[model samples]
Target: MIHCARTDKGMVRTNNEDAFYLPEGEDKPLLFIVADGMGGHKSGEIASRMAVEEISSHINHSFLVRGSGNETMQIIKEAFYNANIKIYRTSLQREECSGMGTTATMALFKDGRVYIGHVGDSRAYILRDGCIRQLTRDHSLVWQLLEEGRLTLEEVRCHPMKNVITRALGVDENVDVDLVEHEYKKGDIFLLCSDGLTNMLEDKEIRDIILGAESVGAAADKLIEAANSCGGFDNITVEIILVD
Candidate 1:
């Protein structure tokens, strides 16, 4: 496996509120995560950083909880839930962080499959056979409208409410996490990113960049560069994981 990641504050954001976690070494069944935060002041950064730490810690300690992939899936869900509760509690304790919340998208690779636990709008994509397919559904107002057939894809892209996510971690005492599993294949590539990248670059453009790049690291750099070139209105983050 080969992986590379990059993040930038972008052209407009004063601070980068995006956080990601990628484990090192030859640890099979590794974990990868991307988080995008929203709140007042610098609370968004705090929320996203807390989420990454909490989730990564929980997953790392869950090694003793052994079971099949289905059982492992449950553990992954629990990690997200625990992370939510932790962040929510922190928000409650800090007046400045009171409505702080973040989007969490996590991918766990084990036993020839990738298990994803998601909330908010950060996304996961799988590239196989020279094509890219989105894996997670956005929990945003625009996505809801698109699903209801009330808006066209073009409208969703430019909608004023595009950033209005319906669900996020730390928003409440509890959160609903969506989980899915994908069968991994050799040569398959996974891209995990915050909405900053997605909002700035179209899926086709992203696909083209990744396909044309010489390495995963190059692809991550190019994605961030492209997002900044387009506007970079938010903090941009990208993670590229290539199966060997």
Candidate 2:
């Protein structure tokens, strides 16, 4: 079974632009999501909420939950795509929300396996055997530079456009999701988080907190607090999962 907990704090922002949900059914580890929305006047909040709700709804409505996809990757991809379309259509009708978009990441667990689908910069990571591995790529310009050797990681961090995301929900009608699978083992831990936390905290700092926290819920809380202790420049969201 999977035990999990998550949170979203708008921090200094006037409105919350992050959202997440932990759906309970069989009570096993499954379907955890985190979204960081972009826009103003509550549009970011709506976009993020829409992303979390739609993805959760899509997965809940699908029959794949029990059918098994151990070696398949299509289900994870479809869920993100469906959520993006719905959010796109929503912005079209609500002129007040035009141009709003969000970065999203989802984690799914079944039979000791973990599947992740992602877009934008939000990420999924696993900590096992005292090592942590990032499982998704950041679809941002700074990230592009880092990958292509155009910009250094340190430079990207302090860049004026550090938060300028290159891809997101409702920004384009079409989206590509990063899909990854990890074979779950006892004592493994997984985390899904928005860039808010990452933007303020270093990767090693995060790993240290996760390793030191007493439980998943504690880890989530401590991570949020740690980010705020720094600058808390934006909203922060995190999901921490433990498998047994």
Let me know the TM-score candidate 1 reaches against the reference structure: 0.97
Clash pairs, candidate 2, are 2-29
lDDT of 1 by residue, 1-244 (tens): 7998899999998899999999855653488999998899899999999999988888887843346887888888889899899889989999999999999998988878789999999999999998999999999999999999999999999999999999999999988999999999899999999999999999999999999999999999999999999999999999999998
* Model 1: lowest-lDDT 10 consecutive positions: 61-70
User: Model 2, 1-244: lDDT tens per residue?
Assistant: 5556555564677666888878667743368898999876688889889888888877766636456664336766777787788888878888988888999988887766777888898888889888888889888888988999989988988878777778887777899878777788888888888898888987889999999988787888899899988878788888887776
- Best model per lDDT: 1
Give all candidates' CA lDDT scores: 0.92, 0.81
**TM-score for each of the candidates:** 0.97, 0.93
